[model samples]
Target: MRRLSETEVRAAVRGGVSRDGEISRPLENDATAIKCFGCGQMEYRAREVCRCGYYLRGQLEAERQRNADDYLSRERNRFNQLRKRRNISLVAFILALFLGGLYVTGNLTMIGDTLARYAFLVSVVFVFGSLKIIRELERQMVELSKRLN
Candidate 1:
């Protein structure tokens, strides 16, 4: 059986509609009135089983568990992506540092002085860019960790 939407469920509890698309006798609006998730039938909240033998409590618990599982999987995927990006940024930062150091010490002599200066400038830019990316990824990971906890 198809599940009812929230509005439809409320209407069902209010005796607004029936499965045959006919107006049913309106039920008294009480705190205990609720619609069953299994058969989409009006039922009392205090009752555990509906007329169709569907256990409301069990269905509710199962739905909650499914939602929690989905949330955890999504968060885990996001965390893994962030970790990969952070790792790539860290590697880039280290490489840029090494290149900049080589240029500064004049250890890379095959390149002309002007080319070496340009290379150093590019490496400096890469270093700062990588640092910024790493910081942002760290912040995101921290936020994900907080949410998970």
Candidate 2:
């Protein structure tokens, strides 16, 4: 309901005659006037819903449901992306471990060059892939904390 100042309420209480000789009754606070969320325009508020032309019947409930659905869809997409990144990081890290073990245990005179080359490639992949995963995880953590607050 609209909250009118005391002055406006008093003025309305004192009825007046318009130029057309029509009597004006005092206005009631039954429905409030508010700005529409979708269009940012003024409209009457009824039953906790804005009577803006943009929405249909039961508009407020529909809008809330729509927002909830959108949030769920976005969260699912984010989880899928994170899963892919995690898998890539895990594989690269495992390869790095295997290559490092071979380098440390293999006989230098027998497979030194081959082990060294594979070790370098593994280290490069492991470092870059892990970094990417770490960055994405940190970003997601920040977003989660923000939503919590």
Candidate 3:
């Protein structure tokens, strides 16, 4: 079989009729064209596969599935990491609350009054910061889960 010249290929892509005089089906508006994924060349959409042997339907679907699987795996890892961090932050927030409560109730009396007050204030700040971080991480995990679904 003779290979088509570039001009001939372009003409066929542009809806030129074959020897049988049958008009090619247009892929887009008024143009019957397909771009080859392997070599980045134009071809008629009626062809089953590109000249470079990239099966249009099957290989394209496989590629899309691979991409989706990769994306989901990355997102799942990220979600797991976020869950771990959120658990850590929850533990920190609880510890900060416990220490702050002890200081406030005078149960931790070894420290000076001013130092205890400062420590309690610092613990309060830590608790709020941890809460903010946990909230943000939870929001992110929720968004990731939605995407995964």
Candidate 1 residue-wise lDDT, 17-84, digit = tens? 55444333223354455667777777666677877888877765776799999999999999999999
User: By the lDDT metric, which is better: model 2 or model 3?
Assistant: 3
Per model, how many backbone clashes are there? 0, 1, 0
Worst 10 residues of 3 by lDDT: 19-28
Ranking by lDDT: 1, 3, 2
lDDT of 2 by residue, 5-91 (tens): 666555555532112222232123323444456666444444344434465335556766999889878776776676676677777
Candidate-wise lDDT, in order: 0.81, 0.58, 0.78
Point out where model 1 deviates above 4 Å. Answer: 1-19, 22-49
C-alpha RMSD values across all candidates: 7.5, 10.5, 7.7
Find the 10 residues in a row with the least total lDDT in model 2: 17-26
Instruction: Flag clash pairs in model 2.
Output: 2-32
Between prediction 2 and prediction 3, which has the larger TM-score? 3
